[model samples]
Target: MRVEGLKLTPVSSAGIEQNASEVASGSKNFGEFLTEALGEVNQLQNDSAKASFDLAAGKLQDVSQVTIAAEKANIAIQLTMQVRNKMIDAYQEVMRMQV
Candidate 1:
């Protein structure tokens, strides 16, 4: 079963490096980038919740869309958690350094 308008693309390391460089070069700060990422995750979660509600209410016909939205939200949340963990680890390591 193929879902229309659903396209999966591989992420490139070069693109990630470019984005990091842009953020580091004063175009955008780390805090703003983090905020935007969190906002996107929140939006994906909201979309998944709405899709679930629609499906439960018999208003949605495509189950694949709902599944996709849920998976997107889940992956975003997992990635956010990983990043948060890494940041905490780095902070603790810095604190362990001698002055």
Candidate 2:
């Protein structure tokens, strides 16, 4: 039996430090993230609507495609609504807090 030369090297300290920094500063502010997420949801809804219209007009052949798209859009909208409700609740709570 012969074993070939095997070498495994761990990540460098500088690489680890860079990765930590990236994780710490990579994300946008909460409001910006929310805005971007809502925009994505809006886009999904628009796509769903377009797919449904295409299906209705006999332009799309697969009913399943339209159904899936619609369901995704519905779920995204519901999630967005829930997030909005939570944000409102948080804001109200903060307002009620004694400063």
Candidate 3:
């Protein structure tokens, strides 16, 4: 599955350092960060579904890949749900705040 016109590259040490600095300086909001993180998780789930289908059809050879992909998708979904719950709790707390 090739993404057209997308340049994929490993995160260099300097890039990681820059991102860390921005986060530490509060330059990136939590909502933006979580949105990007959840997008990655959604991509993982799609990939996992494809891999599992291929494995079931005997097109994929490695069972471990299927298993790992499924597990990653599961964990990502669980984490996203937890984050959503926390956000709902926070909203309720704010609504009940004595202003």
Alpha-carbon local distance difference test for all models: 0.95, 0.91, 0.93
Off by over 4 Å in 2: 1-23
Q: On residues 1-99, what C-alpha lDDT tens digit does candidate 2 reach at each position? A: 999997988867998888678668975566787788989999999999999999999999999999999999999999989988998999999999998
How well is each residue in 5-94 modelled by candidate 3, as lDDT tens digits?
A: 978997679988998899899988988988899899999999999999999899999999999999999999999999899999999999
Top candidate, metric lDDT = 1
Looking at model 3, residue 11 earns an lDDT score of 69
What lDDT is reached at residue 52 by model 3? 91
TM-score of model number 1: 0.76
Q: Name the runs in model 3 displaced over 4 angstroms.
A: 1-16, 24-27
Please tell me which model should have the higher lDDT, number 1 or number 2.
Answer: 1
Instruction: Report the candidate with higher lDDT, 1 versus 3.
Output: 1
